[model samples]
Target: MSTNKEMKTATASTLNQHVHPFDQLTGDEIIQTAAIVRQAKPEVDLVFNTITLKEPNKQVMLSYLGWDTSKPRITKVEREALVVILEKVTMKCYEAIVSLTHNTLKSWTYMPDVQPMLTMDDMFEVEELVLKDEKVIQECRELGITDMSCVFNDPWAIARHVSHPGREKRLMQALMYMRTCEEDNQYAHPLDFVPIIDLGLKKVIAIERIKPRDSKYSRPTIPLQQHNFLPEFVGEENYRKDVKPIIIQQPQGVSFTVKGNEIDWQKWNLRISMNYREGLVLHNISYQDGPEKRPLFYRISLSEMVVPYADTNTPHHRKHAFDVGEYGLGLCTNSLQLGCDCLGSIYYFDAVFNDHNGQPVEIPSAVCMHEEDYGILMKHTDYRNGRAHTIRSRRLVISQIVTVANYDYGLYYYFYQDGTFEYEVKATGELNTHVLAEDESAAGMGTIVAPQINAQYHQHFFTMRIDPMIDGQNNSVQQVDTYTLPYPTGHPKNPFGNGFTSDYTILKDTKEGQQNACYETQRFWKIVNTDRIHPYSKTPVGWKISSGHTAPFFAKDDSLVAERAGFAKKTLWVTPYDENQMFAGGFYCNQSGGDDTVEVWANREVQDIQQKDIVLWYTFGITHLPRVEDFPIMPVEYCGFTIKPCNFFIANPALDVPPTNKKINHSVLAHENSSKGEGPKSCCSTKL
Candidate 1:
């Protein structure tokens, strides 16, 4: 084991590469893992898949979290083990899970290691698989194309895409493109031949080509040589000089202090870590409640993001992607630059990702922590008495962004001074673009952007994993809604329709807890710690979950997406804690059709969710309609949900704030006795 000094030095040395200590798999470790795996299984027909650091089981991690300082035991950080997957060169592709501790192979699990057939095919590179097929070249020959270029397509929404009905399988489709090596616009050039290949057989089962209706061209073809679509700014055009926001800092500097990954504000105390799957994780998050550091959430993270398109056409049907699962969210994180991506005394966090070859690479400033003025958060005014009260709000924003192919998704978790936890999601960047004819109309698939370009329509759905501990751990879900009260015995005022009452329901079982939103009822869900009740309200301390911009999965119940991603069907899901069940779409969802996700786990009819360590999954999405402006680039659209305090605090927590007194100044007016008198001579003259 490495010593503390050695670990610190090692971490500092990797800072030049912008690598995080725990987030990345070191290059040295990867090289050593490769050597060990080869040595362990020397003479086997093994197709190496991935070798990565296997996160330790929760039991072991819990040991660290619950470590007793009074026990007087030596505390040393241990390195995580490695898990390598190797598949046999067979039809079913029997895979083996090889577990290695330090440098020694500890165990292997292979019940023939039969691949789970229900969901996506185990993780594999779509582009690599497409390029490896010799039939792709044959399809190119059939199209009379000599140039070698390929555009990959994902077969996520279409099950019969590779075969007939009732014969669904994991498949990937490839769109053969005509492009010369010297061509400047490779993406613009298109040869309309799509080959649907079975992932298991590695063979082209069918080829769907879009031929010209009037036989105008012998072979299906698109605009050959188009102008470059890549954006370029020459000279000083790329630089920002005259227009920039000036951020003023206080003479005393930032009020908050960050020691390593731990952030300390007025009340919030939490530790953070970044990973390839989940970009940012806040652990041991709690507020200073009186004497002890009261635990609110043990851990909170952005779990899975599924962006399923609405187009039912051939090419667009295979366009869906599991943004977080298929391509790791942290893996696609953008390296943010100062002054551009962030401002005002920002603290940037680094994320380390293991490339396809298992080599560690660092993305600098993958996550940023900064504070922004959120205007007035809390206020109380007495109109009759000329007395006023307010507390100006400053919100600490922790944000991370990931660009998967064309769309850019931003994940933000906000912490306010008044015990409010908010989250925001921003969608920007370009759409999954395509080419169209002059009068094609594009049907219901997409919209026309350029002369012959049909920028397809799509939807982006996101699910946030939240495990709340409101005051204490033993919690239950309380379903609350507003309902119309019975009209008073045919009273004349009954026609006003102004009577209503609040309804409270203790969600008994899983079925009752998994209810959809009702617009008429105006509903919200709350996770309440039944053991911890508020003194004033005489009710359990809880936080309300209110979501917006939510779009449900539009695919048919018998559709591929329905079978594969059942979690998308409902907006909210409540599951009892299962450490293995993390993602809503499931792990290894590359060519997955739907067996490993939360849908599968929820199907077991597991009961006793209430009073247990419960997990809440809020699925929110946008129904995107492509416009001409959405073609080259899209405007930033903001949509998100909030987790606000409900019966959790006795009084306004911001009531203790020192008055900035920006709204009105009664002191100077009273002192001067003049109607036109200004505010106080000193800002802090009045005792808040």
Candidate 2:
């Protein structure tokens, strides 16, 4: 392997050559090699003769984007030996013309500058001239023309003699005189001009004059139509209704735990939480239906206590406590349109607190939530006409706020259908006592009722409900849904019953929804910090930052004592997209699609679980509402839910060893008789 120092040295040397004496030497060598380069390039040759100059029958003029045709222009003429003049002038002119043509042709051509600018007609005319090379000489002999003289005059000079440059531009004059004839309806004949030699003897290339065809003339085309597709009835509604104000209650405490290979539970409890306040007002006005048929609107405001905890034990030397709060909005619509049209905002404020010594101090708190529009659209056949179609578009808006310190705050907004917003807010003061205890009593203190976990925690589950008004009526309700503390068993699959499976099972099931239980329960977490201790001990003597290691449990393991917890064996379900599964999908499939699918599977599981198993908890359509207090700044709302373990595992059985690498290789040969084409062999085909 190459070392870092060696790589740096090589890079430095390569760069040094370009900036020092080596660069000058390289330039000299390039100049010395010009002849060799030219010899290596391809060449073409053509023969031609001088002809009389006649007025063209037709002409065309071209102009640049900003060129003015009213300005006078001067044309210079140079007199030099024929041989030297032709060599120098033709080389420069051909280079410039070829460069311009090549740049334009790059949009389509593949052979670079070799392609000619003339069209098919020009090519056909040139071919005819080549075939009649001797015939043109015979015609001149018949006309009694003997002496030959070459003429070199700018077309612009001729234009000046006939009309001012303001009337006839140089380009227009050249096109008219050289390309067409004034009286005769025939193209100009170049054979009428004689060739002249000044310094050397050399046969001249044939000169041919061409004109733009009159029938081919056309004016540029332009588009002249406009189209708009926005709905005509938007922003025409007046929504106003009265709703009651909400009073928030603080929760007693919060807790955190890591269960069996699943998510780490960060639970909060707001004891007397109100879903929605009363006496709020809303107004509704519709543009299409006038003032009478306007839609009704309502608003409710509520506050809840916030608490935050670490999954692992809190540090003994910690000086401050932290509380985190989140915001959510619930929608219940009676509109036959499925409550599709809705708008709401949430505002957050920090709580004043006293330190452990009862001294009042202004604490800073922040709240943030995903701010986006959320709605649902339904399409059905129109009863009036089975063939006619009717559609409705509903809109929901959410705004989030986050407050970090006493004065530090942030806010964000988003718009989407069925999307949730979350932000983090800080607490004003620290708690005097450590809220979390390393004992079982602390496990179920603030449990919120979650029907799905009732079977496991039974009567231990707690519940709270907040009622918020809808359209100025007591029509909506919000529920603070929480689950009981989970129990941990070191099973890799079905960690939280969220449908995610392990990498091992993912490799086995190529199709969707066929994952094994072992892979389903695994979860990943970042280990912020760690303390090493003697096996079976609770005291830590060493510390290290564990950045990327996985934490896969959401509950405490009862079987392991506090001491054994240090040595506890934890298993995480690895998703198939993990690095270890790279080769499992074969080379081609792996290259096209990678580990991004792991997040997709997790999102799918979240949606599926919300729809099927957890119906008792009412889902607040995703929103981040803006409040008056959130104007100058907003706070972050940390919003998330919890799930407790229930009938999620089976007892372990005797170990069943898997085939070894060598055995897997040999199995391919043994199964060759049953295989077709180049199919891969199964490692399990080997005999035990």
Candidate 3:
């Protein structure tokens, strides 16, 4: 109701509806809307598909609600409506639309860009329908298979695999599995089953079955009988609460200044929120000096992600997924435990969701924020003078966990003491596997995770939609690269691999924007305020965008994965910032025919990007080669990119950061009570 509360609220612009948090209809609103609809047409058996809250326009929000909008002077006006989708089940037609306004529920003329994809019910029916098919049963029986179970394919994934991207057809996908009872039973593998169902047609388009691969070749399945258990201190494993007494306590205190969703630490300031699509989004990110607030980077968030499998077999050929577009990372978020997931003075944020019946559901502990000392941010010592200096860096870790069927992914946004914004994604979960017979080659496809189960190789590609407001709004982009010097003017040039000098090119329009790409010889690009150059260097104050461990797209150009997600083809792309262009994979990627996407927008004649609003799409990913260690679950494999300050600051921004402790104490506990036991600690000036 107030500005302070608005800042704490999870809100978004109409630019991209998916970015809006919990756009799904709230339970009370659904009940009220359903009543409104049924009162008008009693015969309406509405199968509600989508019920999202329409958000205000981005321009409107920025004008009315920008710049520390928490001041009470700002008026708090509610101008939002609910976008409801009501499908008629009896006649097999979907038409009616309704909206909830300040007055009451009323008929609405607006319609969705496309018919929404499979809901949870559709996903369930995928496996249920397969089980009901007599042909499938008879074939399985004929093959002497009985104890197997089934797993549904991610609906978003099925949309990508379908050869016809723009058929204007509604579909759902699933993979057959040879279910096994783990020591802690789980449905982890994918069978050769690829079922494509056409919702409008009300029948399966096709069911393709391919040869199964052997998991035992590399991934030796450890059956319950073969599982090795450590000798128990007590027979009851669940009652291990008494194994050892331990507790997390902070004797001193946390240094983070937290208020609602905002966090201010040392020199960093940021606001975090959880959404259904992009799990976490940070806004108003800045760095602080004494009295002046310096801009480091603004609005960094995960734009979209694509995971494409390598197998070209029948169904496997269509196994790619536009994760953020097809399946929502926010929708799949898991409830995390404080002690188990993270250990410290833990602070958690709850997430909101809506049940099919349109009831509001609160997922507790859906997001976690904490501080961790990363050993040492930087340290150096001089033996000659015995003078030493070390800055033990601390980081603010904001994270959310999402489980997409068989795999668990953790999206982490990290902020360091010295103006560093790092985005890291962790993949650790059961591999999509398949049951194999005795005679099969596990070559070229995957590593065996368990006996008779092969885990295929896949690539997970991601893009970060950076809305850089570098020193205040207007900024520009430039590419810098170093070239080997042919001749040295001051002295003899090293005839060897030798000397080098830097060269740069400004990205002015769409033509020049084409030259931007990541290469080994090039240094990171700078997002700078051209109008406001630094007094010392006469160069614009800027921040550098750096890439981490990333591999190029492996999907062939003609491949479906590439055809639909062309943004993955390049390492980086720059375009004029348009609130409407929030996603790289594209809006409505569920069944996209590759019509409109980031690249499509980039292809538009480029505008003046220098000293103008700019939106950047950067891609990074990993090539997952399965290993036996990836069995039940794999260790978290982290991959991401970082943003560091270039000429943005005059000197080391973190030079004033207080060190951790000057020394370690060897004295025991009792001595800590005496005057000599005050303990060793850093005596840096604690100034505001």
By TM-score, how accurate is candidate 2? 0.16
Off by over 4 Å in 2: 1-302, 305-307, 311-376, 379-398, 403-467, 471-688
Residue 335 of model 3, lDDT score: 83
Q: Report the Cα lDDT for residue 582, model 2.
A: 16
TM-score of each: 0.80, 0.16, 0.82
Residue-level lDDT tens digits of model 2 in 571-619:
2111222212111111111011122222233333422211111101111
lDDT of 3 by residue, 1-688 (tens): 1111111222222122323222333445556655665566565555555444444454444444344344443334333444334444321324334555543555544344454433455566565676666655654554455643522344434645446555356666666554334333233444444566665555566766665445344322222212212234224654556456344444455567765566787778877665556667776677786687765455677888888888766677677777677766766788878677766776777666444454555566777777776667776777896556667777888898888777788888888877787888898877776655545656677776666566889988888888877766678888888877867555566555467888766788755664434565665677778888888888888878777666778888877778778788776778887766878877567766566787777787656777877877888888899888877667888888888887767787788776655342122355264456554455332335
Instruction: State the C-alpha lDDT per candidate.
Output: 0.63, 0.19, 0.64
Q: What order do you get sorting by TM-score, best first?
A: 3, 1, 2
Query: Which lDDT value does model 2 have at 64?
Result: 15
Q: What is the lDDT of residue 184 in candidate 2?
A: 19
Q: Could you tell me which 10 consecutive residues in candidate 3 have the lowest summed lDDT?
A: 1-10
Task: Give residue 105's lDDT in candidate 2 (0 to 100).
Answer: 12
RMSD of each: 6.9, 39.9, 6.5
Which candidate ranks first by TM-score, i.e. highest? 3
Could you give candidate 1's per-residue lDDT for residues 1-688 as a string of tens digits? 2111101212222545532223345556665665665687676555434445555444344445553234444333345444434344343332333343346666555523222222122334454566556766676667565445434343332333445443234455554444444434444455566676665566666777664333445454365545443444123555556676444343335556765667898788877776667677777678776676666776678777777666676556666777776666776688876666666666776765444344556676778877777787766677797556656688888888887655788888898888888888889876665545434556776776666566666777778888766666567888889978778745665666777888888887667657777787888888898888889889888889888777767778877767766777777888887777878876655556577777667667857777878888877778787887764567888888888788887676666666565333223343355546555443334453
